[model samples]
Target: MDELDEVLPPEVTATLTEQLAGWADGAVTLAPRIGVALVLLGLTALVAWMAGQVLTRLGRRTRLRRNLVDVLRLVSNTAIWLTGLLIAVTVVFPTITPGRALTTLGLGSVAIGFAFKDTFENFLAGILILLREPFRIDDTIECEGAEGRVEAITIRDTHIRQTDGQLVVVPNAQLFHNPVTVRTDQQFRRASIICGVAYGEDVDEARAVIEKAVRAVDLVRDDVRDIQVFAHAFGASSIDFEVTWWTGSLPVDIRASRDQVVAAVKRALDEAGIEIPFPYRTLTVNAPVPIRSVDGQG
Candidate 1:
C-alpha cells in the first residue's frame, strides 16, 4: 500500500483523501437526520392511532348514528396521519414546500383514483350515506334484492346481516344508487292478507268474522285504528276479502303477527261454519248430434 501510494502523484493522493473525508463527514451529518425522521414517523403512527381511539370514544358518547360516528373517526385518523406524514417528510426533505407537496399528492391521487375508480366511488357513496343517514346501523333495509339489518358501514362497503343468517358485504355504490327500502322507518306498519270465502257466504258476516279474528291476535297492534276488512276482488270461485291490521314493523314481529292472525282467522271461520273455499272449476258439455253417413244409415 505504501509503495502504491508513493507511485501515485502526491497531489492526486491528497485530493482523493480529501474527497473521501468530505463524503464521510456528510454521511455523519445525515445519520441524525435519518434517525429523527424515523422517530417522527413512529410518533406520527402512534398519534394517529391515539387520535382514532379518542375520536371513536367521543363519538360513542353522542347521539350520532353509528355510521356517522365511524365516518368521523376515519376522517380524524386520516387527518392525524397526514399531519404526521407532512412533518416526517419535511424533516427528511427540508426543501419541500406545502404547495409542492400538495401538487405531488394531487397528481398521485388522480392516478390512484383512475386506477381504483370503483373503490373511490364506493367510498364517496358511503360518506354520503353516513351524512344522509338513509339507514343507520341495526336498521332493517332492503336494497338491490338484498334484505337485512345493517351491521356496519365502512368507506367501501356496507355490512349486512341477512334474516337468513348470512353476512353480506355490499358495495356502498349499489345501495346509494338503487332504491333502499327502510322497512322499520316507522314503528308500526300495516299488514294485509287476502282471504276468500265461498260465494254463498255473507260478505258482511265474513268481514265481521275476519275483523274479530285479526283483532284477537296478540301480536296485532290494536292501538292504531280498527281492523279493516274490505272485499277487494271477486275471485273465480270465491269472494276475496283483504284483511288489514297494524303490527310492529320488524321482520320477526311481522311474521309472528301474521302467523297468529292466520291461525285465529282459520279457527274463527271454522267455528262460524264459514267456508274458505278452495279454487274450483266448472265444465260444460254440449249435447252432440249424430250425422248419417253417405250409405244412408239411420
Candidate 2:
C-alpha cells in the first residue's frame, strides 16, 4: 500500500485495492452458491418434466378431461419451479430470509399484476371455465355472432374452428363474461322454417302436408319430439305455415335436415296441388301515365 501510494494518490490507491479485494472475496464465496443454484434449477426442471408425464398418465388412466389435466400439470410445474428458485435464492444470499423474500415478492407482484392485468384476468377466467365446463371440446358454440366448434381451451384463450375453415382464438375473459350458446348441449334441438302456400290453398291441408313431409326427413328426430305445423302469418300472395321439427343438434346435422325437409315439402306440396307462391307486387300511380313501346310506336 505504501509503495503504490508513492506512484498514485493515497486515497485512490487505497480505495481501489480495497474494492478489488472485496470483489475477489465475493466471487470466491459466490461461485459455489451459483453452481448449487444451477444444479437446483436443473433438478427443478427435471422434476417438473417428470411430474408432467406422471400427471398425463394419471389423467389418461382416470379418464379426466384433457383441459383439466393440462391445467393441473401447468399449476404443478409452476409451483415446483417457484419453490426451487426460492430455495436457490436463499442458498446464495443468507441475508435474505424466506419471510423477507416473500414480502419482497408481494411488493413486486403488485407491479407485475398492474402490468399484466389482462393476462391474469384471462388466466383466472380460464381456470373457472375449465371447472364449470358449460361446453366441451368438439362441441359447437356461438358467442357474439361467432359460431364454431371448440377445438382447444388453454389458460389464456380458446381455439374455435369455424365452419368455413377459419381458426378463432377467443380470450377466456370474453367467454366467461358473455352469454355463450352451446348448440350441442343437448342431443337434439328444434328447428323451424316458414313454408308458404297460395292463398287459395286450404290452411289445414298445407299444415298436414308440411308436417308429414318434415317428419319423413331422415335426420329429423320424431322419436324425441313430434313435428309441428301451425298457421303463422298471412302474406300478399300466400299463407305461411310454421313448420318445426326436432333434429340432431350439430350445425351440419341441422343443415342437412333442413335440406331434406325443404326438398320433401316442395315435392309433397307439388303432388298435393298446393302452389308455393312467389311474391306479387303491384304499383299504383295517382296520375295516369302513358306507356311507350321500345320502337317508339303507340
What is the lDDT of every predicted structure here?
A: 0.87, 0.92
| Candidate 2 C-alpha lDDT tens digits along 1-298 | 7888899998899899999999999999999999999999999999999999999999999998988999999999999998898889999998998888889989999999999999999999999999889899999999987789999999899999999999999999999999999999999999988989998888888888888888878899999988889888887778988888999998988898999999999999999999999866899999989999999999
Work out the TM-score per prediction. Answer: 0.80, 0.87
What does candidate 1's lDDT look like per residue over 1-298, in tens digits?
3765888987888888899999999889878888898998898888877877776777777766756777787787788777778777777777887678878988999999999999999999999988888887888999987899989998789999999999999999999999999998988988889999999999999889999989888888888767889999999889999888999989998888988999999999999999999855798769986889899997
Mark the regions of model 1 whose C-alpha exceeds 4 Å error after superposition. 1-25, 29-50, 63-70, 281-298
TM-score of candidate 2 to 2 decimals:
0.87
Tell me how candidate 1 scores on lDDT.
Answer: 0.87
Residue 26 lDDT (model 2):
99
Lowest summed lDDT across 10 adjacent residues in model 2 is found at 232-241
Candidate 1 C-alpha RMSD relative to the actual structure: 5.7
Clashes of each: 0, 0
